[model samples]
Target: MTEQRSSPTTSGTTASTGDDGGARTGVAALVLLAACTALAQGLARYSFGPLLLPMREDVIRSYAIGGLLATVHMAGYLVGAVAGVRASARVAPLWLIRTGMAGSVAGLAVLSFSTGSAMVGAGLFLTGMGGALVWLAAPAVAVQVYPCDPGRAIAIIASSMGIGITLGSVVPALVPAVGGWRAVWGIEAVSVLVVLCVSLLLLGSRPQVSARAEESGGWRPDRRWIWTVVAFAAFSFGIGTGMTFFVAALRDGAGWTVRRAGATYSMIGVAMIAGGVIAERLSRSLGRMPVLVAQFVLAAASMFMVATGMGPVVSVAAVIIGTTMSGTAAVVSADLHDRYSPQQMAAAFGLMLIPLGIGQMLGPTAGGWAVDLAGDPFTAFMLCGAVMGAGLLPLVIHGCRRTRRAQTPLITGR
Candidate 1:
């Protein structure tokens, strides 16, 4: 059998820099990719989750419609994901990053200027599409630029999602001062545009990968990849609900004001940043699957706490949930990076997103229906918990099987 085990330390580059110099350059590259991630994925895609309630009350005017908007947004994500996979093979990765950033600004501009539902849908769809491209390109570039330490580099970039969400959630606090939510979008657009320009200047041309690395980890229809997809999908379903409706849950379920929920959401963002910072370290120390298992279990527990109406615990749970999810994503991204070369990353990662996109697309709608059926967000929260908890078992079993198989030959003296 081929070596199914993933090693984060392997790389395609031949660098001879001093440790300190390499560390410095890696950090700098990480920051650049993180900024790009924050702008493209965070500001562009995640902002919608926190902004959903306000948009519903002020503009959307219905729960079903709001859910529909989220579904549509994710639909666009699916489309963009497919496009990114194909485009990355033919285009410069930096160009795709630049395009994603520019598209986000354009989408936000549309959302800022329009009040119609069609416009909202169109804008959000565009944002989703752009976010997909950003998500695809940023890490691809990061791993390439800092191939010496792909896990840590990818973790730094992935952490930007939390930062972006935190920043977006805070916008409601400025609603009164900025005149309206639309103004917030306008400001974010300007800020992201600036980030986009910076990314273009900093990202430079795409680095060429050695053809050997490109063709090394050929796709194996193994149980491991299948479990990864299943785990990722389940996690996506659980987190997508919280991400899209956590504020609504707080407002409707916990009876907190939207402002209060938004503040709490910011806390989750902080946790996400912390998670990003710690993900690679923890994965390196403890192994990727263990870290992922711990995070997923913790996320389920956190959601359960929220479901039980433990108010004080909700914020704490939010922190753990955010940390685990982001950490899990970081570890998984790094694992994929180890599995595929820069030339093949876009397609591999994009293919992985198929299940994730489907799960995300279904989450909001499913959560909404659960709320409607149970007449409370509590049931939806519980559903999230159950799905996540169930998802962890398969991963644990499969990972153990892989580990045992990897060790069997040595134990048998083969």
Candidate 2:
């Protein structure tokens, strides 16, 4: 499940090389890829969570319906990922990344033009598909350029997603003073387009992608890699569940105001930042599995704290959990780099996002149900905690097997 970078073609055919110049060029291109991810993920992908309440109120969707909308958005993302995974040969992944970002930009632009439920849903689908494509393509670039240090390269690229999520939250708070919720999409569209154009100009001299892919073997992840992707999907799903509705749950469960409760979400974002930096360093030192298991465990604990009710202790616990869970993007991306062929990079990562969609679909619904039935958040928090804990089991078991195997002796010398 590994592919080498493209070999240097004969004079002027494709201009491939393993020279320092080529590596540097490819790394520069990856910087653009990371920039693209920062733009798409921040504005198009993650902004959904912050918009949930305002959009739901405006469109008159039930809590369950809100869950469905998120599910549908992720469904489109799943399709995009599968599409990336099915490549016949190495095409220029950058082009696909650009096209995806463009589609999301267009979709966001259109989202501002209507309030009809159907239009809104369609816009979200395009947005999801676009972001999925960017995420799929960008990391492939990261791995190719720094094939010798793929994990470090991928961690740098993956960290952009965390940055994006944090920025996405900031957008919502600005929505009111700026214009309206719809205007937020318009602003992001313009910002993304400008960044894309600027990146193309400054980063134009990079080596052609075809050169890189040929070296990396080709554009196909093995069938075996799908299982790992599914596992990551589970990991992402549980994390999303805890995070997606945390602020809303707090406000509802404890009768806190939006301003008062939003801090918890912000703290989660800060934790994500801290966790991301640490995860990258840790993954490099210790490898992916150990780091990933630790993160899942952190997520489980954070969910318990979040569910327990709002107190300083719970808040700290939420920070610990949120940071740990949300920061999985880097470690998982690196894991994909390790477990699959480079060509299959985007598709594999995209496939893992499925469980994330499922978990998010459940979070609000379950959280709402708990609030209703328990008559206090105490019961609901317990339920949320349980869901997160359930999510952690598969991974911990998987980790245990790997650990035991690592400890087991190899056959004696002949």
Candidate 3:
């Protein structure tokens, strides 16, 4: 019983009518969806990076507590992903995402009143939970809408996360000049309101599908997607470190202005949009694993370049990292979607993000602590790059396996 917002269809392809009425309606809906997801994720993802210094300075709390707030958020993200994996396929991705957007407002509101570490941790954890739900549903929804081009659609949604991260950081640099941290958060709440309205308009009372039942005949609903989870975690953590803390990293090391650093990062968002376009087109010809490996390698190199400190180098490098980072998630999702069809798309989605959460959690503290330990940020930056490089080993090995398999039939003349 799949009740979905759909066009009348034949077998594999959907039918198009005169004036393309269905196409117009679908485009409008997609635009609304992108706007809402970008707003929802941007609020949760970037708000913390901009607020990190202010929160620590204003509240007299530990940096550990501050960094851990992101971890807590990712922790909640983990929980939400797990839950979404279980429930999202059973329900509408729109419903879960909307609920997550609403939850973000509550988390932001709670942070406004906090005095210490507990507040930081609790606020981030709950906020992460909400963000996790929204993020989990987004890819699933994108897949539903563009079944044949899920990679491209997922890349777009993933790119939106990058947009949110950039907006989150940059908005503060300007707004705080006028209103302080509280002002930034007030704007966050309002932005979220806009998202809610758009979501209702685009996603309103829509029929939903169960991807789980369609993909899996009688496979267990709760099967653990271990490999998929690991891949996402690695990719997520590597990127998270950059988004959550690199602005501060630039400030601490080179005395770069927050605005300058934030603006530099915005390039990453632009690059992500570009990478997504490439990923979609290439997926048809390059196949899955090859494209993914290339993205990961590029992602690692981008981190290394940043840590090493190249003034002009960052501009081009940032574009490369930003663009490829989001694409990494799309690749992982494609891999999972091709191989498995468990009941819990959301949970599976979230579980895959665990490494991202963990990597994100480790990235900042390690970056900061290494600088603290080494007496220079260059050493610290190099170390973080190394950790990121190490994560790529799994992808490299996986790629090798795929290549060997592809060549096997040719070599044996099968």
Candidate 4:
């Protein structure tokens, strides 16, 4: 792939590294974009996991239905991701970011007043769509601002989602004080809107980060890329199942308080904040495939611990799972950057997300079925671990064969 370098420019004004004022403005714009990512993805989308129990009590009663709601959200995300691939080719990154944030704000507002399952699903769907658009465009904008270190910029953008997750964990604690779940959504809507406005002010003009795939002969998937997608899908399945039901399992099966579960869940977000950086460094020394394989193995072990529901062990497990989840995505994204030109990056990455999204969509509902059948979440969690392990078998075997080939001695004919 040809390397594409972007010179930072906003509203057609060039901002070179030597210009101190312009550099500062670019940095500020990048920071605000990261904030938008946090609100759009972390608060609007993932806050659902922490608030699921209350939602169950208030509107959704069945575990199956609860899981279906998550599936509905993922469906919207899948659609958005696919659409983003095309949209990125035409729209400015800043406009896409702003539009996405607006959608999230609307979704959160709708959720605050929703009293039935249909309304709740609608809100979640909109939130999921908004989150996808922001995530799709944010990294490209970051790369434009920090052209010297695209990897670092992307990692920072990825990590910001963890910050949002960590903050959202505090919502469960304030559930009673502020009213119920509806009030929580209302507060988040207002907060996200405030951030969106600030982001608009900071990002005065569109960053000239063009993603015209037509110039690069668009993205085409190969056999190796398919294997990577499969691996990612499996990882998503395990993570989606584990995260979606984690708090509920602790409360219902393990008999823990909501406060305690929420506290423990916060560890996942805390670890996730450093996950991308850690994975990037490790991949530099160990190679991405080996690092990814180890991550899958560790994730399986952690999910098993989560199944046990022991307090301390589960907390440790949460950290492990969180790190692996974010680390895997970071490693995969870096690999994509290495293989595809900037023009093709958006389309390639967006297409790749489809399988992972499908896996996530299926995970929660399958876990819910397992829970309903077993009359507890233990079997569901165990099944998730098994699914994660099983899904990566092809990739593992391919890696092993490649390693063996490398170690073999070459025979010379004289």
CA lDDT scores, all candidates in order: 0.76, 0.63, 0.64, 0.80
Candidate 1 lDDT over residue span 1-414, tens digit each: 321433322434443335878667666766877887887788678787777776777888755677778888888778877887777656656677778888888888998997788988888888888888888777766766675666777788878788888897888777789888788888888988898787667656434333342432555545766787788888888887878888878888878898988888888888888797697688777777788778878888888888765668888888987797678879877666555555445556777877888888887788877887778877777898888788778888998888898999899996
Give the TM-score (vs. native) of candidate 4: 0.92
Candidate 3 vs 4: which has more TM-score = 4
In candidate 2, which residue pairs get closer than 3 Å at backbone N, Cα or C atoms, i.e. clash?
3-216, 4-215, 4-216, 5-215, 5-216, 6-214, 6-215, 6-216, 8-16, 307-381
Task: Count steric clashes of candidate 3.
Answer: 17
Give per-model TM-scores. Answer: 0.89, 0.80, 0.84, 0.92
Which residue pairs show backbone clashes in model 4?
Answer: none
Show the lowest summed lDDT stretch of 10 residues, model 1. 1-10
Model 2, stretches more than 4 Å misplaced?
1-28, 87-90, 145-148, 203-205, 211-230, 339-341, 344-385, 410-414
lDDT of 1: 0.76
Which whole-number lDDT from 0 to 100 does residue 216 have in model 3?
Answer: 27
lDDT tens string, model 3, 12-99? 2232334467556555555566666676666565677767766657763544455556667777777766676666546656778888
Better of 2 and 3 by lDDT: 3
Candidate number achieving the greatest TM-score relative to the actual structure: 4
Ranking by lDDT: 4, 1, 3, 2
Q: What is candidate 1's CA lDDT for residue 360?
A: 81
